[model samples]
Target chain A: MKEKEINFEEAMKQLENIANELEKGDLSLDESVNKFEEGMKLSKKCNDFLEKAEKKITMLINSDGEIKEEEFKIEEN
Target chain B: MEYNPITVTDLNKYIKEKFDGDEMLANVLVKGEISNFKRHYTGHLYFTLKDENSLIKCVMFKSYTTYLNFIPKDGMKVIILGSVNVFERDGVYQIYAKAMKQDGLGSLYEAYEKLKSKLSQEGLFDVSHKKKIPFMPKTIGVLTSNTGAVIRDIINVSTRRNPNVHIRLYPVPVQGSGAAEKIAKGIEFMNENKFADVLIIGRGGGSLEDLWPFNEEIVARAIYNSEIPIISAVGHETDFTIADFVADLRAPTPSAAAELAVANIDDVKETLRLYNNRYKIALKKRLELMRLSYEKQIARPAFKNPTQKINEQYMLIDMKVKAIQSSIQSKISEEKAKFIKQIARLDTLSPLKTLTRGYSIVTNESGKTIRKVSEIKTGENINLRLVDGEKKAKVL
Candidate 1:
């Protein structure tokens, strides 16, 4: 969801779907391999995405219908 | 000197002007029980305020009734601040109330109830209209005052839940006049830009009046109409705002809203790992099962020694061919014997047999067998055949 290109939820759901398909044990060995590879790739992508990203915060301002965003930093209390 | 008498209206006007001139009457604060309560269709409240011994007429005009937060009813004790004056037309003295409060409670609670019921009846709080909050919101648009514990709490909570989650604070007034409008506008702005998948709108705890903007109709309507799912966290727990009812989800506090809005990245990562592990285990199991079945098939004798199996089939074919050839040979032999037997029977009836029995078959020169002596020439050469040899003999 953060990247929009990679919807984390969708990727997770698809990975789960692949897991289920593999667990059903009806697919040919070749098909199972393909699904396993796909699932592994998705898992890696999600892991990297979560691990590499840092928290971002921005203060928003609207002036005359124009919205501007500025980096926000928490000040010491 | 005072012989002339004026009209009742003129006398009443004089008394009213005198009462208006008195500063004490102009600004009076009274606490009494309400009786003979009636509301005019013109939105004026008329009631009699009385102690045990005496009573005074009070009228809160529609203009001043705007300040009333509760519906005044009979027998309800109240403190009213207004001016006492004479009504010139009716020749009656009444208090013009500017504001009224319930004896022990502020009227804000009643107003809150009133609006809550009104909006509830309108189905603004219908569950079916609520949008589902996202499981993982990339950005959480927080609508609250920027410089407060509310914002700080939300940031702390959200970042703790998922450090990757971006927070966009659309700072808005949590209370005071026109605060509702500002909040509503913030919601609109967020929605317009598709700023966040979920919005957390709220403030820190405050008094009922301080949290009034959240209970406002405009803010409620804004929450209702927002395309993005909203989590309302107005004031502390136990404080209910109309925004809470209309929002997709309600958190008791700003921190709770943050918790509600963000998905824990670690948990999600763990889930993904589980899925990966499941895929690994399942696929490995599947491969192992296939390999075992394949190995079992391969372990069969036919598969183990393919050449021997083929040689065995060849040997079977050779045996079958040999058996067929032998059967044919015996059949030929049997037929040959039958033919020999038939030949022997025929041979016994043959003239050659008589030859073999020491008789001869004689024929003339023309190779015709002579059956009687009359046809034979005396000196004609003839051939005679015995069984084994031929003799030239004259027939006598």
Candidate 2:
């Protein structure tokens, strides 16, 4: 499968499906390696997403009848 | 009226039947403070509901306890909906409570109850209408007061699970007259702009009046119509607002809503690692199997040297050719021996050999051999031939 326009949830689901196919174990050697490469790329993509993720907290503020987003900071207790 | 007097148990049974037949007594709704509240170990609640002027004993069985979100305590004002029934053994009448709710909000409790049943009957709380909450929402829109623990707890819980999750706060009044409209408008805004992947709309625990905004019809309808899934977390665990019933999912508190919104990064990372490892192991196994088949091919003798088999065929052909050549030679020699033996026999039968053996052959001059003397009698002379010399003799 091509990696175009894929999200983390989709990638994760595809990886799991590949894992199940490999476990069933009727595929040829060539097919197995191809699937392995595809699954590996998806796994790597998911890992990169997790590692580079940043939390961006924002709030919706209405000023002069237009709604806009502003950065939100937590009030420390 | 005829009096059929008997035992006290009989009188109690008769009076119990009379109370059971009365429609007013069958469905009684009373508002009073709870006193002598006793929770039996068997899960029945024995209590006395008393106003300043009157009092009534109420017994709520274990089956009815499930509907009571809050535990009844002494002096807590509540409305009990039950029927007047008699305990025959005690010869006294008490109320069997079917449902109860915290009162003192006056008709606000009535409004809350009325809206709950109305929305429920409209199928707004149907499971089919519930939207699926995204497992990994990029942003979580929170609708609550900005000054309290509601927003704080949501932020902390969501970030703790996955630091990548964004919390977008759309602060609105949680109570008072117009709070419900603001809350409903916030839900609409989030859906219209596709603001957040999932919305968390809730506030800290409060009384029925304080949590009244969540129970409003407009807010419940907004939640029901949202394209984006919502997680309603109002008040405490026992609090059940109309929003909770209408939402796609309901969390008991704000922190729980946050937890439901985001997937843990560590766990997801672990899943990725597991897939990577499985890929390596499976690919290695496939490669190893291919290599073993290759090695098996190389180990085959015919595969090692294609000419070896041809060379073996050549050797077999040479052996067959040699056998054919030797068989022909032996046949020729056997024929040659038979020819030689026949030649020797011919030589032994030759007249020269007879002559050498001192045997004489007599014949007329015509070269014909005579076996008897009479055959040559007509001849005037008989020739006698010797091995070394010849002589002529006349016969008398």
Candidate 3:
């Protein structure tokens, strides 16, 4: 069975490696086909991971263990 | 000693006239080492011009001070252009300086320019030689005083931006004797040991004398030669130094340098999210293209009725088989008709047919239907065999 999931970093690294190998043009037809298939899977996985990510906000406190949770606003340029 | 009631301005004017008329006091060019210099907030410079034996106070307004390219420091020899004057209120004689120039190229500026030009010639300030600061540095090496607001500011800004960045402080004096050497050594050590991805060398804002170590040739050379990219953040924004020129990057303040070194974790996460979104969008587009192509292929006649293709080949074979069968049948029939004709032609010449037409097939009792007379003897019994029946007899 093909792997249905991969993290963003792993997928990106794999994609980069595949791209490099393809650029080198050393792979046989069968190997190239296999790599292309794997790259497609990884690309899909990365896209899926990115689509699901949401921005999370948290507050910072001093070493005294004080709780300070405030609404963090994203600054706009 | 006339007891005349006069205003302060009158007394000041009377004393100014007396000093202005004196030939020796007017337009005196004084040569002395400067001391206790203060640039007034109103843009006037006040300092004491002192010789080994005597000292006099002098003032140069903003109009004159702006013309000076180099900052005049304490103990620097300068030729002052001013006239002698006495204030009646304090009875103090002073040289109100109009202009001043350096007595000589002092030890500090000379060393500064010498090292700057040398390193610049060696391509230290070249853009190609400067290493780019990593977008997200994992660790930052700080070379500064152990206890100072500089470290605090750096920590505050960095942690605020990215909480996870590791900071290692290589404590060294930021000024005074041996300070430049220590700072240089710290930079070298951080680079040699690969302690951090980037280094922040800085101190808080201070007077030029306080920030002298950063201007030292040693510190500048160290920054120029550093393998790890260095961000020089010594003093305020207006302050420029040799270290600033040699460093891979220059930041106005320590906090700014820290900000440059690390990426905000939140911002990076957001960026990553955006990238992921873009990847997803691109993937979706590609898949749509693939799907469209697939649909087009499926809509093709070959895909719609695969059996039509098979039937076309099947019909070709069927036609060929029918052609072969028909040809074989016709060939067999034609040959059969030829054979029958041949048989009919043979029957006409056959002796059996002649026998039926009243010609006798002579034979002996031996039942040998003889083609020659030698096959039968005088008393031998023979039987004649025709195409319809056969009669047999024993040979005598």
Q: Residues B1-396, candidate 2: write the lDDT tens digits.
A: 999779998999999999989999999998999999999999999999999999989999999999887768898899989999999999889999999988876687789888888999999999989999987776788999888899988888888888887788998999999999999998998899998889999999876778999999999999998999999999999889999999999999988988888888888888888988887777777778779989999989988898999999999999999999999999999999999999999998887778778977776666577688678765356666666766676556
Which lDDT values do the candidates have, in the order given? 0.88, 0.87, 0.75
Residue B145 of model 3 has an lDDT of: 79
- The TM-scores, one per candidate, come to 0.66, 0.71, 0.58
lDDT of 3 by residue, B125-237 (tens): 78887888876555688888767688778877887887655677767889888998888887887777787778999999875667889988778778877889899999988
lDDT for A53 in candidate 3 is 33
A33 in model 1: Cα distance from truth in Å?
A: 3.6
Query: What is the full ranking by TM-score, best candidate first?
Result: 2, 1, 3
Q: Can you give the lDDT of residue B393 in candidate 3?
A: 59
> For candidate 2, lDDT tens digit of each residue in A1-77?
33334576777889989997776667898789789888987787677667666788888897776998888887777
Backbone collision tally, model 2:
0
On DockQ, who's better, 1 or 2? 2
* Best model number under TM-score: 2
TM-score winner between 1 and 2, please give it: 2
Which candidate achieves the best DockQ against the true structure? 2
What is the clash count of model 1? 0
Pairwise lDDT winner, candidates 2 and 3: 2
